[model samples]
Target chain A: MSSLLNIIVVGLLLGGIYGLVSMGLNLIFGVIRIVNFAQGELVMLGMYGAYVCYLFIGLDPYLSIFIVVPALFLFGVIMQRFILQPLQNEPMMQIFATFGLLLLLQNVVLAVTRGQGYTAPSKLSEFVISVGPLNISVVRLVALVAVTAAALFLSWFVKNTMAGKAIRAVTQDRRAARLMGINVELAFMLTFGAGAALAGLAGTLLAPIYTMSPQIGGNFIMAAFAVVVLGGLGSVWGAYIGGFIIGLIEAFAGYYLDPALKTAIWFLVFIGVLIVKPGGLFGIAGAEEVGLREQN
Target chain B: MSKTDTMSGVTSTRDEGGAVPPGITTFNTELLRIAGIAVALLAVTWVYSGDPFILNIMAQTFLFAAVSLSWNIIGGFGGQFSLGHGVFFAIGAYTTANLYINWQISPWLALIPAAILAALVAVAVSWPTFRLRGPFFSIATIALNEVAFVLANYFGSITGGPRGLTIPFKAGLENMIFTSRFHSVLLMLGFLVVCLIVCAWVFRSRLGYYLQALHLDEDAARATGIRVLQVKLVGMAISAALTGIGGALFAMYLRFIDPPTLLSLPDIGVKFALIALIGGVGTLYGPLAGALLIVPLESQLRAGLSASVPGANLIVLGAILILFALFMKKGIVGLVMQLWDRFGRKSQ
Candidate 1:
């Protein structure tokens, strides 16, 4: 019973990390309808941004979030404006372009870092709380708290704000949204920037936990994709909840099955979900097909 | 004004007072074109016959060209942008390596089973995944590649695990291992010829038309009574089988197979699509044009920049991919066609 409890706790913490990583992806995917293969790279850049802050200015990883998030937002806007916006109509080109960005960012970092692993030290890295055979790291707890707060904030933002409503309108129908006089492109640029900013936030939080490598984005990318799919495309709450589902599955699968095979196992689950519910748990029934339709 | 079709096998164009439409060339003419291309490639091979470096590069170029041609069947013609073909390539490599290592089976004989297994796996996975459209399909395929990578690592007994499998050197035609680089070049050239023939045949066949129709508009194609799923499956199977054969040849040529070496997304999976895209997605000879340019350029970059900065080659390749996607969506073939059209019009 204690072990099961431990697994649940572990899963929830892991889910927090996954959820945080996937939030930005879900937003971009939901609104822009581009997979943004480089989102993980954006997260990686955020981690590095935190590292650079520590290296040059001696800023804490947590405080670096202020600098990193806005930087990534600007970066995202530029990328969407220059790279993705032109290829908006061509989904295939979008995939190629984003993948190109993935390779470029990853390798550029690799060349700069020379594959050396860096760890961004944080004051919160060593604290842990124990409750009746269940031990929780404070850093993880912080991530969980941050994700919940972010989710609530994002939900509220999307619900109440004019900008959020505009994003929703764009997601629903690009042509109709355009007819309503919404500058769909500006909305996309903002959404992408916000999404990138969220990814930056995830990176800052995650930096202290994992040894940073140029290829670390790869580790999160597939898992985040699983989270995004499980939760549903374009659904904020879905990504939050979906992250935990994947985390629990991964945690349970890792313990029960061969640890190495956990990724494969969840991939099977992802495929099954795709087969059974193509739109994901929280996604509209046919949103998966809707993404492929000529929105313009 | 009488003019011959320049964009033969690309798009069907009605010619004034002509019974046969331009771009719908007879099979014999395509065969002749293939023969001409083969001869041209052979001449290039003859020029670099003595240089081992060029021979190795040529061999790889042909191999990748063939694999990209296979990818074109589904990715280009059918409009399914798969990012998981590395799975099929790995399947082929491991299957052949296992057969040759364990059973003393000839690599040539192993090719048949490898192709069949790849096709089977392709059909099985794509059956469910075909329901996904656009980037969703790509995401699923990428997941499949990752799954294969994990499984390949775990199932060490068969795949030799992360340590990978290396075949012993035995110089013989039957063994498909040779000391001379020239022989490998010839073998790859032969493979390239076979892929070209198959692609050409498919390009002109009913299946090709069906694939193109669906590619243009899936719902409309379905409305017209085209069996969308079946057509995609058949195309994927054929593409996977050819990729499998290419993998077998790759394993034999390298005499080593590892999870990362075979299944790396950037190196194996995306490279095929990149070549196809850079050449011309749907054009018959695009893969060849792409391979001819990309393979040599990559090797040169690796030689020049890799020592100074690791992954510099990929940085350039990535930039090329982005630039191509942005400005040159139609790729080298498309550019050539536009120029050809201008010249033809000027002459008229």
Candidate 2:
């Protein structure tokens, strides 16, 4: 029971991270309607960024989010403007371009880092909280709170803010949004940038727990995707909920089944969910009509 | 084929169809042209390149071509990007490898059942997962492939696990192990011939027509009375069977089987996909042409570059994929066909 609780707690914590990272992936798909296969590599960059900062400036990872997020956001905006915009007319082209970016980013990191593995500073790695009869790592607990708060804050931003409304407008109907005098291009740019920032934030938080490597992003990205699919495409809240559900499933499966089979087991869950509800748990039923299906 | 003749006449009469430039001829007729070109190329290589090592590389390329062709049936034809097909290849390798090791059974005899078993496994897994399209199906295949690897690891006592199993040194047509590279080349040619025939047969079948339709537009195909799900399953089965055979042959050629080579990150998985994508996705002859270009380019690059610059070729390979993905989307075969159209027009 104690072990089970541990697994559950760990799962929830990890799920929160998954949710946090996937928010960007989901947001880009929601607004821009492109499945950035490079999303994982972007997270890898953020982790590396935080790692570099930790080494040089001795910045705490949590505090480093302020730096990593903005930097990544700027990178994301530039990527959208320079690399992605040319292929906006073609969906497959977008996939290829981003896929190129994914390969480029991964190999560049491998080349630069020489595939070396790095861990965050000792304090961040060691920071853990032990409650009575329960042990909760402070890093993860803080990550969960931070991620939840970020998600809630984004939701509020989307609901209340004019820029958020314009973003939503673009997502709902790009043509209509254009007609209404919204700068659709700028909206897409900002949306993509913000989404990338979220991925960076997730990476910054996760750098301490997970070792930073060129290939590290591939490990959790699959689970993050499962969360995206489970939450329903383009629904931020759905991503958060889906993350927790997948986390719970992972926790239970890891506890009950072979630990090595955890990834495959979760993939099975992904397939099952896809079969049962293509739209996902909190997915918009007719949302597919609003998104990039037309482009494909 | 009537379709080819009609398409040619259409291209000559008026330019139409934006997806395929009207001046661009249909793929059916272009395949024959590809075969003619391939034959000429092979003849040149056969007469000139006296080096057995070069012939050896070509043999390996032929084997990869077969694997890529098999991948195309499901991935290209069915429009299902499967990253887990290494599982089927591994299954085929393991099946024959185990049979040869334990009973000293002839590999030729073992391979038949190995192919069947691989196909059966494909069907079993695909039946549940085919319902989920796109990334879900892809991830499931990846997961299942991993599961196969894990199982292979756990059963180390009998299966030989990570250490792998090796076929005893035996020379004969019966044993399926060859002493000469020429013999392996002949065997690979035979395999490629069979796969090509199968691909041509598929292109002429109702299932092929349905698969192409579904690939282009699933909803449209469904509306037109094409059963998209059934066709996809059939394509997947055919694909699995072909890869299984390729795997069985691979075991015979190497006379050894290991988990790391058979089932691992971005080894077979990357190569097969890269070859298919590099050649052309939908065309039958695309993979063959792709493997021909890529395998040599890869070997040459690795031999020359990796010594001076570690992972240099990988960077180049990634760049090439991106380039192909962006610009040469139709791949080498598609390019050949396009150029053929352009030149053929000038002569007309």
Q: What is the lDDT of residue B205 in candidate 1?
A: 91
For model 1 chain B, where is the 10-residue window of minimal lDDT?
Answer: B1-10
For candidate 1 chain A, the 10 contiguous residues with the lowest summed lDDT are: A287-296
Using lDDT as the measure, the top candidate is 1
Model 2 alpha-carbon miss at residue B149, Å? 4.2
Question: TM-score for model 2?
Answer: 0.88
> Where in model 1 is the C-alpha error above 4 Å?
B1-22
lDDT of 1 by residue, B89-124 (tens): 999999999999999999999999999999999999
Q: All models: lDDT?
A: 0.91, 0.77
Model 2 scores a C-alpha lDDT of 0.77
**lDDT value, residue B161 of candidate 2:** 83
